[model samples]
Target: MNAVLRRHAGYYLPFLALAAVLAVFPLVASTNMVNIGVFALIYGIAAIGLSLLMGLAGQVSLGQAAFFAVGAYTHAILVTRYDVHGLVAAVTAVLAAMLVALLVGLPLLRLRGHFLALATLGLGIIVSVTVRELEYTGGTSGIFGIPKPEFGGRVYDSPREFFWLLVPFVVVGLLMARNLVGSRTGRALSAVNDSEVAAECLGVNTFLLRLKVFVLSAGYAGLAGVFYAYWLAVVSPEAAGFLLSVHFLLMVVLGGLGTVWGAITGAVVVEGLDEGMKALIPRIVPGATGEVQLIAFGVALVLVVILLPGGLAQLWEMAVSRLRRRGSAREPGELPTVAVREGPRDDVPGTGEVSLADLLAEADVPERGTVVLSVRGLTKRYGGVVAVDDVDLDVRAGEILALIGPNGAGKTTCFNMISGVLEPTAGTIEVLGSRVEGRAPHTVADLGATRTFQNLQVFGSSTVLGNVKVARHLRSRSGVVRGMLGLAAREEKEIERSAMASIAALGLAQDADRSVTDLPFGRQRQVEVARALALAPRLLLLDEPMAGLSGAERDELAELLRRARDAGVAVVLVEHDVDAVMALADRVAVLDDGRLIALGTPAEVRNDPAVVAAYLGTDDEADDIVRHAAQEVR
Candidate 1:
């Protein structure tokens, strides 16, 4: 109950306070103050869209004001020129904005960071200039005479009346933004922001994701513009000016980039400051309001950058964290804790003796077992560099094959080729005997080949369990549209259960609800592995799964891999840990400079002269000969 109260107070107190001010300000303040409040609400809405672009998808867009103006113009034209109903005009404006966003985003979202910002800044300038020059848009004088929206013989004519009208939309927009950031779309967007290359490797289409977010953000800006048009009963080129774009950018940077509620708070604070400055500067400084306010804005922005670079959300987080730390320090080790039970160890039934034949039979692939995958003459080249040179590999049902190599030996390149990431310069990849080469990465993943990266690629923003749940979506009956509509075929209960199970598989059950960032590095690696295993692929490709793990963790992973193999899943292992590889591999393949050097049983490979030279260097002949002679008879 206390935690609930704290959470509500942390998240909703500002909103509740704003609600009270909006409700009572009309009675206490002048009509002008009420107008200022309404304008703040509209700016808040635009800021949410800008926040989505800059914060979530990691795209820096300064053209939100352009999209904003386009929406206002759309609403103005539809209502005045086409005689469209006010509500219909609002909807049309949003759709039109999305269309413009799509056209702009398809090309502009292709650019990264500074380039994106420059492109968007150019777009905003274009929109501002176009609005000024186009006669249909009323030129520099701006469009006027837009009447208040009327519904069922009722019209909102006064500022006070429109405050009541706009408040609900402001609330709804906040909720919608919150819901979006918490959904799959939000997670994917955050992932893209953090690392586009990593997200692409995870089968996320970074291009389409950027475009989707671009359109969504523009749609929100459009809706806000429509509301602004109706509220003001006029439209102006200033609505899409470079200054307005800068203001939205300031809001995002000040409030917090990635959090929805932060965007809301940022919009209110920045716009409220603008209004306060407008009122105060004119009264105190008389004729210097314009220059004085610009100087003050610049100084305030500098202070914000210096003092709170991570933004207001980080400030709030820091404050709360400090309070929690103080409270926890008062009672050391009393916070909360969880215990994990290890799974039962494998043993011969009621026997003290364990036979090698039995162990080999249990670990071995059966005759006529499903051939889950086949790779034939797979070759990849980077210019004159042969990254993977005519490699042939197969993964049979229920077998674990380890790929061992020194650095730069093309193991990863082979994995990439098989996973459909790098299109092979030559060769065929087949899943279940069906040729599937040159397919997209997601298509290869959908066809039952899932992999984990050498370096951890866990979604740090999401909970540990949430990371795994996303992989479950690969097999989900629901499409993206269906999930957005809350009509996913699988029940929430089932997804939750599956997610928990996957989390448990890697002994991360205790950390399921914890943000992956908070976990130890080894555990984060486990989360990555669990996420890949959640796909339930017929063949799993683990790229250095034991990398950066402790002795205990390596043992746990080896046991987990053994259990997975026993359960009828084929695995391709790539690791530098020779001890673990020798213990776990049924067959080991060695590579040297993108060419296969040796393929044999662990005993044979351990003694192979070529393998020793590739690993220990050719100069260590005395040690190599002794080691080879010792292991040759094994």
Candidate 2:
């Protein structure tokens, strides 16, 4: 109930208020104000498109104007030269623009950050130049005699009547955009934006998702372009130039990056400022109209970037929260929730739902097994250096197996072979009674296997819920189109319930809506674990789960891991923290120079002479100790 109210309260309430204002606006405001509203609506459409691109897809597109122009020109040609209907031409124009965006974004979207920005910028410049040079576009003069739509056999003759006509389309467009951005596909775009690597690991096709968002963004720009051409009865190169594209980007940034209403707010505020300054400049500075306006606009943008990086939406949100707090104050004797707390529960079971025995039985892995993950005579060499040399190891089920060595011990290389990140040159890898060698990482993951990276791999820009949701996608039975259309899947509600349950299990319900960036390092680590758990794998490989954690945080994580093990999940933990390995691991494997020198219970491995000697020696000297120990054991 609270969620429903929160959803409707923010922009929906404002939208309702705006409807009232728009209804009475024509009667109260001047003709100029009405004109401004129409213009703002059109600009809002473009802003919405750019927001989906730059904000949602995490692509920096400085070429929105190019797509915008394609739409406008396509409509102009279809309606005038080809004698097509305005409505049909408009739809065709949008499709044409989307095709163009897809074709261009396919290759260009592969580039990261500024590379994408610059590439799109180049595309915009090419478009602007082409339009200016082409005879069909009327060069610098542009195309004229663009036909306006005649609806119900009556032409829209006046600007006021035209405003009413455009307003509905604008509203419809906004609704569609809202729906697109609010759905699962929309969240996927955000996931890619946040972290492409992590998204891919979660079974998201990042490239395809990028293309999808590019097409959607371009489609919106295309629709807006058609509206602009019909409203002005002109199509020009200047209308979709690089500067115009920048203007759209600035609008989204000034409004808010991720919020939908921010686009409209940004468009209205910035465009109104532009118009107001144009009017005031001539009166105040005489002939310095252009120069003065640019100076003022630049300064305003800098101020916004510095003071309101979250933009107007965040500012408004903060204001409303403050207002609510002020409206109701606590009595002097009333204690805060923070001041009251229940004691810990001794009855609550640990993290996993099943016992270790069950997990081993399900995977057909023995409690004291033969090799579950074995590498024999494994060697990976680059040029003259051998990264992993004739390494042999075994990982048993139902044990916390620790793989630890110095930075260049090829510990990662060994893991790469086991998880199928790299091919072993001279060995076989048998996982779960199959010769699962040289498969892709995803293929490895699909075979009851899941692994985390050594480096932090949380989707930083996405909310805690968003990150976990991506994890659940691997298990989601719904297809892409179903999610986009907001259709009820076979188990849509069930999937949602399951995702929430996973979040709750991680004790992250309080931080569910908060972005990973907002959380501390320890919480982000927990988020990663939550994601892995969502995969529902039998063999869970954790790479340094406690890296960069505080002592207290590490202790808590250790307890969490113990609970997970207790719940029938087999875990493989790789860490350099000897104390943590000793405390949490049922059995430990010590890796030096890519070969396992010692593998036994924590007490046995800790007491191993070779294990002690390897730690005592320098990083380089450890490899010799591993070799000697392996020979001695054999």
Best by TM-score: 1
Instruction: Provide the lDDT at 409 for model 1.
Output: 95
lDDT of 2 by residue, 284-375 (tens): 77787588888877887788778988998889989999997887678999853321112211123333233223323343334544445766
**lDDT values for all models:** 0.76, 0.74
Model 1 error, position 428 (Å): 3.7
Q: Candidate 2 — which pairs collide? A: 352-567, 354-567, 354-568
Extract clashing residue pairs from model 1: none
Error of 2 at 134 (Å): 3.0
The TM-score obtained by model 2 is 0.80
Candidate 1 ranges beyond 4 A from true positions: 1-21, 282-286, 326-368, 433-440, 477-493, 616-634
Candidate 1 TM-score, C-alpha based: 0.86
